[model samples]
Target: MEILKLTEKNIQDEHICCAISDKKCADGYQKKKDWLKTEFKNGYNFQKVDVRGKVFIEYVPIESSWLPLVGKNFMVINCFWVSGQFKGHGNGKKLLQQCIKDSKEKGMDGIVAISSDKKRPFMTDPKFLKYQGFEIVDEAPPFFKLWGIKTNPKAEFPKIMESAKSGTCPDKKGITAYYSNTCPFTDYYTNQVLREYAEKKNIPLTINHISSKADGQKMPIPWIINSVFYKGELVSLEMKVERHLDKLI
Candidate 1:
């Protein structure tokens, strides 16, 4: 079992035959093909796991800032899969190790994965994220956890978030703040300022921690307020924008 970078040659129709059902992954071939060209530019790490020429696993580096909240210029394992024939072969664990090795080789800080909980298999189990040393970073169920295969757990969450190159953003060319009810910075901002005013002072836009999907579906990402998002990009809004760096620092 070799965890390899997904090249244009190997990312094909059967790339994930054992990981996901043929029906589910059949449409992903083209998506992967498209991904090979666009993934790196978007500030993400995309790779596949192959067993004797059979590509069956994928690991995606996150394209967002939340991972940065983890101490080590961190990254999240966005997409991970392993073939059914290889289940319990320690392949999942091995694949993860390989990813970590690659991360260090690439000069990354460290990695965080949203893994499968103890309740189910690696793919669909919402609670499975705990197996890989990932902790619940926010109140949201599966999406807000912070993971690291070989990193510290007690480090403080960061206030200065260095954003990823790109990811899923609802707004185009404006900032999007995924504030969660559980995040302290998010709480401070929402309580103290006018919504639009924060957007103007910070640029991009501001989102209070609301019960809408627009805020964040997973972990309800309600913690950010002093962020500059240009059409969905989370950036450093301003020094005065963040309360932690402002009042606390």
Candidate 2:
């Protein structure tokens, strides 16, 4: 299978591997495409296999990363997915190697990715990353883990931002969601489904759309793209609106 790299010229018309046929996510899909167009200027890359499945990787330079991790001259993986029937076929390893090659060519210190203590939606499995030679360099509350593979022995290890270490939102009441255009599902969930659901329940809901890197850097959760907090405590980071609604009720 051929791997396609999305460029500014073709990104507008390309299917981004997620929300390919979901009419409900149409708005969010466009938002993600628009977001990628802007991030491309900031050294972001989105590559995926040419298949009708979610088998792709998205990455950017550490300096341009949206997450609250500090490191110099490294590449940060935002998303690495090889879902559906693509698993166990080495597609993931191939995609990951491409990122490593790109980072090496750019003379980066290494590559870093955010994972969790266990499997979670919107997060890569730490065990797979560990098997690929990544090691835990730092940890944040609520099971967020920073995984890194240093190309330079002397390079400083990446660490979670001080603000994110606590993993607790300031809003202690109602439903609060912090999301960004990084994921296509976020816009649909936050602006449409989730919002409507909350209103139907007569619950106060606050949705904060993270518009800049600085905003993401201060987010309590490492995975800030689509995190929901109930009563100031972190809840689901996944975009499953119905699942979240059940929890809320």
Top candidate when judged by lDDT against the true structure: 2
TM-score of 2: 0.96
What is the number of backbone collisions in each predicted candidate, taken in the order shown?
24, 0
Candidate 1 residue-wise lDDT, 96-208, digit = tens: 67777776676565565542233332232344445565555432222233445444354443222323213334466434554433122333343344354554565445453
Candidate 2 local lDDT, residue 158: 75
Task: Show model 1 residue runs off by greater than 4 Å.
Answer: 12-28, 52-57, 60-72, 115-132, 141-144, 149-249
Task: State the displacement of the C-alpha of residue 166, model 2, in Å, after optimal TM-score superposition.
Answer: 1.2
Tens digits of lDDT, candidate 2, 134-217: 999889888899999988889997788888888889998788889999988888878887888788888889888899999999
Model 2 segments more than 4 A misplaced = 241-249
**How much lDDT does each candidate structure score?**
0.43, 0.88
